[model samples]
Target chain A: MVGSDVFRAKFFSLYLPLTLYLVFLLFPFYWMLIVSFKPTNDLFDMKFSPFWIQQFTLENYLYLFQNTDFITWLKNTLIVSIVSTILSLVCSIFIGYALARLRFPGSNFLGLGIFLAYLVPPTLLFLPLAQVISELGLNNTYWALILTYPTQLIPFASWLLMGYFRTIPKEIEESAMADGCSRIQILFRMVLPLSVPGLLSAGIFCFTLCWNEFLYALIFMSSGSMKTIPVGTVSDLIKADTLFWGALMASAVLGSFPIAFIYSFFVKHYVSGLTAGAVKG
Target chain B: MAANARLKSFSMRDFFDRERNLGIMLFMAYPFFLGIWLSLTDSMIGRAGQFIGLRNFVDLLTDTIFHQTAKNTFIYALVTVPFKAMLGLGLALILNRHMRFSSPVRAAVMMPWIVPTALSSLGWFMIFDPVFSPISWLFRNMGLISKNINFLGDPILAISSVCWANIWRGVPFFGITILAGLQSVPQELHEAAAIDGASVWHRFRHVTIPSIKGVVLIASLLSIIWTFADFQLIYILTKGGPANETHIFGTYTYQIGLQATEIGMGAAISLYMFPILAVFAILLLIYLRKEQ
Candidate 1:
C-alpha cells in the first residue's frame, strides 16, 4: 500500500476539484428546486440570493394543477412508460436468455444486430417512424409511443440482461437439465430469480429511457390531450402565451421527480446496469 | 459444459430460441431498411410518397441550411465532446481514490444525469432566461458587465450556452463510467510504481491511463454519439435558434420534417447521420466485445 503521506497528497489534490465539479453537476437541480419554490417576486428580484428560496410558496404547483393539463400529461407519461418498460423487459429477458443460453443459430449476429439496432437513435428514426406510425393509423395516439419505444429500449435492456445471464453459472442449468427439468422450467424457476438485480437494473433503464424520450413523443403525439410529460410540457403553448416561469419550473420538477427518485435511490444498479449493458455492448 | 451435452439431447430451448433472431429482424426491418426506403421517397403532406431515387438525399446535400446545420453539428460535437471526456476522466481519477464522504459526493456529482434532461434543461433555461436569469443577475452584481446576457438570444452565447448545458448533462455518466474503469486497475501496480519512485504524473501516464484507456475510448465514443444525435437539451434550451444557429441533426430534422411538412428531406437529413454514427457504433461494438 502507498504510505499515509501519499494518501493525504492524493486527497488534497482531488477534493477541491471534485467539490467544484460536484457543484456544477448538482446546480441545475438545486436551481430548479429553488425556482420552483421561490415566489415570483423573489425569483425576479436581484436582492434575493439566487441560491435561497426566500418566499417559499406552493403557488406554482397550485397554478400548474389548477390551470394546466399537467395531471393529464403525467398520467399519459405514466401509462406509456409502464407499458413500454414492461414490453421491453419481457422481450429483452427472452432475447437475452436466448442469446446467452440457447446457442441457437445466428445468435452472434442476432446480438450484433440488436447492438446495431440500438445505435439507430430516435432522432434518426422518428421521421420514418412517424410515417410508419401514421400508416399504421397509430398517429396522435398513446399506442404510437408505446409501440415505437421498445425498438430502442429492448436493445439496451436485452444487451444488459444478456451479459447478466452469461455471468450466471451454466452448471446450474446443466444439473437442472440432467434432473430432467425442462429448459423453460429451469429458466423460469432457476434463472429468473438469480437475475432480479439485472432485471431491476434493466427495468429502471427502460423506464428512464421511456420517461426521457422527447423526439418520438413530439413527432407521434400531436394532440394537446394525448401528449406525454416531456412533449406536453415543452411543446404546449401555455408558456408561449403566458411565460409561466414558476409553473414551468414546477412542472419541470414534477416531470423529473419519479425517475430522479428511482435513479438516486438505485444508483448502484443504474451504474452497473449501464456499464454492463453499454460498456459490455 | 454438461448443459452443452444435455441441451443437444432435448432441444428444450427450441420454443423461445427464435425470439432473439425474430426480435432482431423486426427491430432492424423498420429503422435500418424501412427508414432508408423512406428517405428515398417524397412522402409528405398527404401524398403517397412515390420513390424519387435519391432526390431527397440530393436536395438535402445541395441545401444551404442543411449544409449549415451539418457544420453546426460538427462544431457542437467538437466543443462539447472533449470537455465532457476530460472533465469526466478528471473527476473519475479524483473519485477513484479513497476519500471522506466520497460516495455521497459522487452521488451528488451524478445527480444531473439522473434527472430527466428535458426537465433539468428547463431549470438551466430558467437560469439562462433573459430578464430574470440568475446567471445574468450574478454577472451584473460582479461588476464585470452591466448587461443581462442574452444566453439563448445571442448567436455565440446560444451555441456555448447549449454546449454548457449539454456538457453539464453529459459529464456525469462519463465520470461514473470512467470512475468504474479507474477502480478496476489493481492497487498492486500503483504500489509497485510508487516503490520505484515513479512520479505521480508518470504512474498515471504509464499505468492508470492504459488500464482504463478502453473505458475512456468507449465513454468518449458513446458521448460523441449521444451529443451528436441529442435533441432534448438543445431543443429545450435554444430550439435551434437565435435564428437556427443551434440546430443540429436532431432538432433540424424535427423543424423541417414536422414543421415544414418536408418528411422526405427530413428523413434524408437524418439518414446523413448514418455513416458517421455507423462508424462509431461499429467501433463501440468492437470495444464492447473486448470488454466481455
Candidate 2:
C-alpha cells in the first residue's frame, strides 16, 4: 500500500507538467480549429471558450473553395511541390551515388561545397537569384520557382542522400556490376531500390519546404493564378476592408492537412530524416 | 592474335579508367559559380549599372540602414537563441518521463512547427490587431489596461511581438532536438548520481547538460542562422512598418531590392550577411569535425 502510494505520487508529479506543456503548445491550433467552426461574430469575443463549438458550420470551408482562388492556389502548390520533389530526388540520387561510390578527385570538395551551399541562407541568395531568373526570362511563371528552388534544394538533398547512400554496402553494387549491369542500371536496379525510404523522406522534406516557402514565391511569382498556396492564401484572402477569420482558418487547416497527414503516416522515418539532416549537419 | 588480344584489353581498361568528373562539375557550375558572378556584378534586371569595383561594398559600409539591420540581426539572434534553447529544454525536461498519452502529447507539441509559417504569422497578426485583438480584450477585461493595445503598432512592442511569434514557432525545434538528446542519455547516469546523493540540480548540471551540450550547440546555431534570415513571419506580420523600426536584414534587403528597385544596393546588403553566416558555418564545421 505504501509502495503503491509512492508510485502514484511519482506518476502525477512527472505527468502533470508534461500535460500542461502539451496543452500550451496545442492551444493555438485547437483555437484555430474552433474558430474555423464559429460564426464570424464569435471569433473576437472576450469570453471565448476554446475547443468547443457553440454553433458549428461548414460555410467557412464552402466559401474558401467557392468564393476564392483557393482551389487554383492548391493546384499550383501541388504542381510546384511535386515537380520540385521529383527533380530534387533525381539530381540528388545521381550526385549522392557518385559521391558515395565513385572515386573522383574533387568529390570531397564537391561534398563540402554542397553543404556550404545548403548553409547559405536563402535570404542572401534570393536577391541574386531574382536577377538570374529575370535574365532567363522565367519571371512571373511557375518555372521560375521550379528552377530556383533546386538551387537551394539540391545541395541539402544531395548531402542527406549522400550520407544515407554511403551506408549501403559496396558489395551489393559490385555484384550487380559483375552480373553485366551498367553503372546506371546498377543504380536503378539496386541502389535506388534500397534507398526508397531515404528518397521518400527527402521528397517529403522538399515538398513541405516548397509548400511553405513564402519569400521566393512572393518575389518570383506576381500573378494570383501563378502564386503558391502560402503567398496566394495571404494575398487573395485577407484584404484592406475585412478579415475573413473563418475562411482564413479553414484554408490554414486544409492547406496544412496534406503534409500533416503525410507526416503522421511516416512519423518515425520523418523524424529520422529531420534529425539526420538537422542534428548531424 | 596475341597483339590483337592485348590491344582489346588496353581499350577495355581505358573505358573503365576514364574519369567523368566533368558531369558533376557541370551540374554545380550554373548554381554555385553563377551565383558568385551575379553577386559581384552590378547587373540588375533591365537596369544597367556600371561595374564599379568595390563601390557597393563602400556604400554598404557607410549606410545607416545596413548598420541598423546588422545590429537588429545580432540582437534578434541573441534574444531568440537563449529563449528557444531554454523553452525547448524546459519542454524536453517536462516531457522526458514516461507518462500516459506522451506520444500524442509529443505530436501536439510539434504542431506549431509543422504548420506553415505564413499561416501562423497571419494568425498571430490577427491576434495582435488593435481593434479586434482577443489578447487586448482579455487584458481589458482583467483590468490590465484601459485601451485595446496594438501590439504591433509601437516599435518596441512590435519587436517584442515578432520575437514572441518567432519564439513560439522555434520552441518546438529545440524541444524535439533536446528531447531526442535527453532520451539518449542513459537513466543509469541519473540513478548513479542519485545513489551518490547528488541533488536534482547537481545531477542535471553535470549529467544532463553535458550529455546534450552538442545538440544544444547545434540547435542554437541553427536557430541563429534561421532567425537571422527569417523574412516571412516578420514580413507577413508587420512588413517593416510604422517607420521601418522592425526591419531586420532580410526584410530590409527585400524592400530595397524588390520594392524599392535598388537591386545593386540590395545585393550589397544581402552579401553582407554572408560573412557572419560563414563564420558560424565554419564554427559548426569545426565542432562537427571535433565530434567525429
Candidate 3:
C-alpha cells in the first residue's frame, strides 16, 4: 500500500487544499484585523494595497476605549456569561448525576427530554421567554440573560455531564461508597475531579454562547451600558450616523478576543464536546 | 433527620433525583409548555389574553412577510447545508489523513467557527463594502470589471453575500464533525477494497461514503436547523435589507414579534419551526441510539 504515486497524491490533495481552506477561513478575520489597525486615510485609498496596511495605529482601540461604553459592555457581557455559566453548570451537574446515577422514575425520558430541549432552536423559545422575563420585571436587567441562558446551557451541560459520567468506571463509585462516602461526597470528590475536561468544555460552550448571543441581548438589554459584546459592538460601532470603519473593525476585534481566547485555550475540550453532538453529525 | 442518616447508610439505594428534576422542570419543560400555550393565545405585552386558538398561525399563513421569510429561510438553508456538508467532508477527508501538523491544522480549521458569527459578519460587512471591497479591487485591477460591485444593495447579490458568510462560518463545524466520522471508519474496509484491486475512487465510493453517510446526514441536518434559525449574520450584514429580500425566519420573527410588538404573531411564526426541527431531532436521536 506504500505507493510512490500516492505520496505525491497526498501532498497535492492534503497540503494544497488545506492551505486554500485555511486562507478562506482566516482571511475575513485577517481583513478585520487589518482594517482595525489601518489609518483612516490608508483604509480608503485605493492606491495603497488593500491587503497590507502601511500605517497602523491604536487610534481606533483608543477611541473605542475612550469614546464609548465599551468597558461597560465588556463588563456586562462578562458578568452575564460567567453567572450564566456557573448557574447552568450547577444545574447540569445535578441533572447529569441524577440521569447517570439514579434509578428514578422517568429518568431516561427526562434525559432525552433535556437533549431534545437543547435541540430546540432559540428562535422557537425566545418570544415566549421574552414574555416570561418581562412578567418577572427582568427586562433591561442582566438577570434576564442570566435566567434565560440556562435554558440552552443546562441542556448542553447536563448532556455533556451525563456522557462524561457514563465513562467513569462504576467500580470506582462502589469503592468510594465502600470507603464511607455519601452520594454527594463521591460525586464532588471523585466524579467531579475526573470530569474536569467535560466541565471545562461545557463551561466554555456556555460562555461562548452567552457572549455570542444577539437576539435576546438585543431585546432585553436596551440600556446603553448593558449590551453584550456582539450586540454592543454592532450598535455602538456600526451606527447609521457614524459608520467609522476603523473603529467598527476595532470593536469587532476587541469583542471577539475573549471568545477567541476561551475557544483556543479550551480547544481540546470544546472540540470533544462539539463532536459529541456531531458524532451523530 | 433520622431519615437522612438512614439514607446515607443506604446511599446506593436512596440517592435523590431532586436536583436533576428541578433543573429540567424549570429550564426545559416550563418554556416548552409556555411556548405552545402562547402560540395559541392572544398573548401580548406580558399579558396572557383569552385563548384565540390558531389565529396567530392562521394570520402567519396569510402574512406576506411571513411567506417571503419562509421562502428565504428555505433557500438559505437549502443552499448552505449541502455546501457545508460537501466542503466539510472534503476538509475532513484531507485532515483525516496522517499528517505531521494535523493538530495545528485542526485548530486552524476551527477558526471560522471559533470567532463569533456576528463579529465575523462585521468583518464581512466591511469586506463587502460597495466602494472598498478587496475582491472588487482585485477584479478591477485584473481588468475584469470597470468598477466596484454592490454586494449588499441588490437583492440577489445581498442573498449571495449573506449566504457566503453563512457558508464560511459553517464549513469548519461540518469539517470537524465529518472528520471525526472519517477517523472512525475501519482501516480494514479500505485495505480490503484495495486488496481486491479496487481503484481509489472505488474504495472511497464503497468504504468512505457508506461509513460517513450517517455522519453527513446528521451534520447537514444540524446545519439546516442552525441556518434556518440564523438571525445574527443576516441581522448584522443585511438585516433582510434591499426591501427585506434576505430575511430568514429568525430575523422576521424578531422584527414582527419583538420590534413591532406583535408578540402573538412572532410566537406563532416561530412555532412553524417545530415540525421541521422535530423531524431532524428525531432522526438524529435514532441514528445516535443506533450508533451507541
Question: Which scores better on DockQ, 1 or 3?
Answer: 1
For each candidate in turn, the interface RMSD (Å) is 2.2, 6.1, 4.1
Q: Could you arrange the candidates by lDDT from highest to lowest?
A: 3, 1, 2
Runs of candidate 3 exceeding 4 Å displacement: A1-10, A275-281, B1-16, B19-23, B40-51, B188-197
**Local accuracy of candidate 2 as per-residue lDDT tens digits, B141-216:** 7899999998999988988888888888889889889987887789999999999999999999999999999998
Answer with 2 or 3, whichever has the higher TM-score.
Answer: 3
The local lDDT score (0 to 100) that residue A25 gets in candidate 1 is 84
CA displacement after TM-score superposition, residue A18 of candidate 1 (Å): 2.4
Candidate 1 vs 3: which has more TM-score: 1
lDDT by residue (B1-292, candidate 1, tens digit) is 6667767555524665565557656755756577787778887746758999989888777887788789889877767778888988888878776778765676677778877787888888888889878788877888877988898999988888888888888788889889878777899999999999999899999999898889888888878887788888888888899788889999998998888887777888888998999888889887877876
Q: Give the deviation of candidate 1 from the true structure as CA RMSD.
A: 2.7
DockQ of each: 0.61, 0.45, 0.55
Native contacts kept, each candidate: 0.67, 0.44, 0.64
**What's the distance in Å from true for residue A102, model 1?**
2.3
Question: Residue A71: error of model 1 in Å?
Answer: 1.5
Candidate 2 residue-wise lDDT at B14: 25
TM-score against native, each model: 0.94, 0.88, 0.92
Task: For candidate 1, write residues A159-267 as lDDT tens digits.
Answer: 8998888888988888888788988798789999998889999998889889988888887888888888888778762367567777888888899888767766777
Ranking by TM-score: 1, 3, 2
Which candidate number has the best DockQ?
A: 1
